[model samples]
Target: MKFKKRLWKKVSSIVLVAILAISVTGCGKSVSTSADASNVTVVKVGTGNGMPPFCSLDANGKAVGYDVDVLKEIDNRLADYQFDIQSLDFTTLLVSLDSGALDVVSHQLVKSDVRKTKYLFPDQYYCLSPLSLAVKTDSGIKTLADLKGKSINESPSSYEYSLLTSYNQKTLGNTLKINAVSDLSTADNFKQVANGQVDAALTYQSTYKSVQADLKIDNIKLTDTVLVEDTYIMLAKGQEKLTAAINQALKDMLSDGTLATIAKKNLSEDVFANYTSLIQTTN
Candidate 1:
């Protein structure tokens, strides 16, 4: 009887030890699976769909473009943060960013003093492009002077509008006619010009090149450059930390030639090269 009792005690001890070991191992895996930051800080980025080479939806319903690529590279370097993209229309993007629905925007946004009052821009720009007036080929419009008292359509929220507005006020003494459109595509702008609804349109050189053939804008021609603006990833107001982190990532990419590589891959040229000289040449 004594021997049986001792044997039973030993068996109970062994079973308890085995059970405790299994419990510990299971607990460890559970803790690891739900590790820190599972409730992570996710950065919401907004971009417009169908804006090719900048931001667009792929067949897999993914955001793929030059802007998206740069954002992904930044996200890869930021382990503490997860970045997600929401595709919206061109006009809706600004509203969403202002309402805090989006944390960042990278649809070829240009920094301007007017914009600086509303949103925060990073310290560096990822790309640059010259602004020019797109008009009908035979419109006989060749310079800013030709736009005097002439009508042009542009998005009110766009920097192009502000640029043109500045030119009207400061350079031309506000004689140019500015038509504010809520939303307009590159094709639509060219169409308006082609149809003689507007005498001219303000657009980026890169934008014209990308959609010129598609729009079949044989009748439209670009005037001499008006201004050159550097494009940046716009952030919501008061995101100083996020802005600094992104700026650092951009600088790293610039130094490592990643920025130029991405530009070449998407734009077919190094848009960053000689940007200073290009901007200087703009009037």
Candidate 2:
């Protein structure tokens, strides 16, 4: 009887140990899944529409471009965060962010002085987007000197407008008539210049390539770069955690050569390969 009792007690102890081990593991898994689901935060990301290769509407009106893809990849790496991307007008992006409707602006954002004062930016730059002047072949606008006292088209909310405004003030004596146009697409701006409606328009070569292929625009010629803008992801102020995550993602993308691949697919060239020649920079 004593031997039987001792054996029964040992068996009960073994059974209880197994039960507790299984229970703890099952409970841990359930709790971990629940915590993961509940802790994931949704981040609102915004990008400007009408800018091709960076952000634009597809045939189905879905937002597609390098900026969009980069945001998606960033979202993928951060399991704790979900990104909801919105493609909107260029000017509307900044306005929405200021109103607290957006948590991030994923457009090829230039870290201008004014913007740096208002928005937070990741430490790593994703791309170097250089700006050039688009002019008619016979427009006699070979250089900035040639654009003196001439009119140009730009968006009021853009850094181009500020640059042109300041350039006109300092050099052209405000004679460079800068037409503030927000509704015109980038192609239309080039079209206006091609049609001689404006002497020139500050734009990107990548944009002209899309315009040329899509609209058969041949009269416009791109001059040397005027600005080499250091583009990065823009976040609303005080988002240190999100900013850190984005920076890490950018660094990883760079290390893995994904940034170059994306740029080549959309921009037709690696925009970052020794992009050091420009009249000025938004660094």
Candidate 3:
């Protein structure tokens, strides 16, 4: 009787172990990207969806694009932190970052004096956004001077708006008729311009190409004029350690040519090359 009881006890223990293993494998919510999580800090990164060439969601709803690829490379270097990327709209991204729901914002973010007061921008920048005015091919708008007293539609929360706002302050207040549209697709914004709803749109050439491929945009063309802006990774004001880690990762990427490779793959060119010249020329 004692021998039989011992064998049954062993069998029961094995069954219990099997059940626990099954439960752990089947329960999806608790699983993490990290194989071991005792020492890793998971960073919640918020980027935009459908902002292709910069950011977009895949079929599995995972964040994937130029911005996301940069962040993933940064994550690989920082063994101490695992980045959890979330796909949010442009507006929701900043809102969530401000509210601390997100640890970082990586959707081709730019640093401004006003933004500096609210967020911490690391010393190293990851990308350059070459912005230009997209107008109807025959709008006869040749230069920035042409935009004076003319109307343009842009999102209030966009860096383009901020850049234009600075231009307005430096030259004339509200020189360009700025229409504040909170939400719109790139294709839709071009449609607005194509249909003459607005005179122009502030955007990048790569962005224009991405939008152009999605829909017919024979009526629209990007201006030869460009304004180059540095894109930074935005973090909350107090996260010193994270900021330092990110900066270090950025430095390494810069040194290793990884950043340029990634840029060439996603952006169709190595934007880093002669970017400073572009900035100087534009400014």
Candidate 4:
């Protein structure tokens, strides 16, 4: 009987150990499955409507442009991530990005000191375009200094407007008169310049090209490049790791000639080359 009791106790111990081991194995499998499911990241991207050569919806309602293509390439490179782009108003895009409703935006987004304080800009600059004055071919206004005491299309919130305003405060002493137009469309602004309405329109080379392509701006001539604006992909605050990852991807794309190819395919120019020219000129 004593022998039988001892044998029964040993059997019980073995059974208990086996059960505990199975439970631990089951828990380990559950945790691993959960981790795998969590690994797939979905990124929400924000952009503005009617912004061509960067982001615009087709008649089929598909996002098409250089910015979109770049994001697609990044998505392809990062297999764990899926990017969903939502088109919103330009103001709303900034608000949404700040509010964490959107993870990223690159609607010709330039780096500014104010934005730098609030957002994370990857070290990689994806594109650059020269800002020029779109004036009537006969106007002969080759520089911003010519705008002194003349009417030019100005948006209260624009890089060109800011630069012009600063120039006024510094040298011109408010001599430049700004014609603030209610309609800020590039086509309309260019039209104003072409029709002798505004002295000149501050416009980006890319925007001027896109507008010219869509409509005949035969009368308008773009002045010498004034501002070589650097464009970047902006992320909302507190996304350091994601920003680093994207910067790495951008670096890879630059090294592999992927970025230049995309720019050529979309904008018909090597945007990186333009940026390089800016750096060289600055140096």
Q: How many pairs of residues in model 4 come into backbone collision?
A: 0
**Comparing 3 and 4 by lDDT, which wins?**
3
lDDT over C-alpha atoms for residue 60 of model 3: 91
For model 2, how does the per-residue alpha-carbon lDDT over 1-283 read when each residue is reduced to its tens digit? 9999999999999999999999897776231233476888889999977888789999999999889988888887787788999999887888899999999997877778899999999988888787778898877676667787788988787877887778877784536788888788877887888898999988777877776788887787888876678788999998889999899999999889888888888888877675735425566
The Cα RMSD in angstroms, rounded to one decimal, for candidate 3 relative to the true structure is 5.4
Q: lDDT tens string, model 1, 60-171?
A: 9888778888998888776566789788888788889889899999888877777788888888887776678899888888777888789998777777777778777786
> Model 1 lDDT vs. the true structure?
0.80
Compared with the true structure, what per-residue lDDT tens digits does model 3 show for residues 25-103?
Answer: 8775432354555778889998889898889877798777899899889988887788998888888887898788999
The lowest-lDDT stretch of 10 consecutive residues in candidate 1 is 28-37
Winner on TM-score between 2 and 4 is 2
Error of 4 at 270 (Å): 1.1
Question: 227 in model 2: Cα distance from truth in Å?
Answer: 2.6
The CA lDDT of each predicted structure is 0.80, 0.82, 0.83, 0.77
Worst 10 residues of 3 by lDDT: 274-283
- What TM-score do all the candidates reach, one by one? 0.79, 0.82, 0.83, 0.80
Candidate 1 segments whose C-alpha is farther than 4 A from its true place: 1-40, 58-61, 172-174, 280-283
Model 4 Cα lDDT, one tens digit per residue, 169-188: 89845467776655377787
Cα lDDT for residue 226, candidate 1:
74
Name every residue pair that clashes in candidate 3: none
